[model samples]
Target: MEDKRADVQELSDFELYVYETVAEIDKAGGAANIETLRNLIDRPEEDIWAALSHLVSANHVHSTAKGFTLGPHDWAP
Candidate 1:
């Protein structure tokens, strides 16, 4: 069977930070707002939002009226 886990594609340090940020937020049982993620990742607001947007487009994250959360497809082994 094809692995249902998310592939750990080669990623830059910043991209990996984004991935970890999403996972952290999920584990914390809270949503990650752009501002909150920015603070957590120690990145600029624009960069954080951009990363979040990329994650959203890649089906790794979902945006709700409140903020962002892991998407249905974001399963890691």
Candidate 2:
């Protein structure tokens, strides 16, 4: 095999799930918290929180006391 998975960056399943959730939320509107995002993404709390941390560090999302919102400059592409 020629390393077919080379294009992947070795993200955890939860991270990928979080990315999808963020994308969905961004498309729909913006911002989601643990409960709301959990409902939207239909995942567990731990996974969602872990992914949120990653997204926040990557500047793809932001966290507030209420919930998380897509970053203002996330559309830089």
Candidate 3:
């Protein structure tokens, strides 16, 4: 399968949901970790990880030792 990268705006619904969830967590002063995502997102661990990978590659989300955060490209108003 071709691993074509999609733009942030063109991200799949699930990907967007993951991105938004991370953002929400960050806004709430909480770390957007895998465990936290698993708790909030009603999806399997693999799916969440995949969404996060894509988001990180697209610079929509930044991953750090602490957790996920908004990348250079701001999605905020």
Summarize candidate 1's per-residue lDDT along 15-77 as a digit string, tens digits. Answer: 668877877887788888877886777767887877776677666677888788777653563
Pairs that collide in candidate 2 are none
Candidate 3: which stretches are off by over 4 Å?
A: 1-6, 75-77
Model 3 C-alpha lDDT versus the unseen true structure: 0.84
For model 1, the superposed segments whose C-alpha errors exceed 4 Å read 1-11, 73-77
Q: After superposition, how far is residue 41 of candidate 3 from its true place, in Å?
A: 0.5
lDDT of 2 by residue, 1-77 (tens): 32122112555777767766766676676657677777777777887787878777766566776567665442533
lDDT of each: 0.71, 0.65, 0.84
lDDT of 3 by residue, 1-77 (tens): 53444476779999999988998888887669899999999999999999999898887888899999877553464
Which has the better lDDT: candidate 1, or candidate 3? 3
- List candidate 2 stretches off by more than 4 Å: 1-10, 72-77
C-alpha TM-scores of all predictions:
0.72, 0.60, 0.82
The most accurate candidate by lDDT is 3
Sorted by lDDT (best first), the order is 3, 1, 2
Better of 1 and 2 by lDDT: 1
lDDT of 2: 0.65
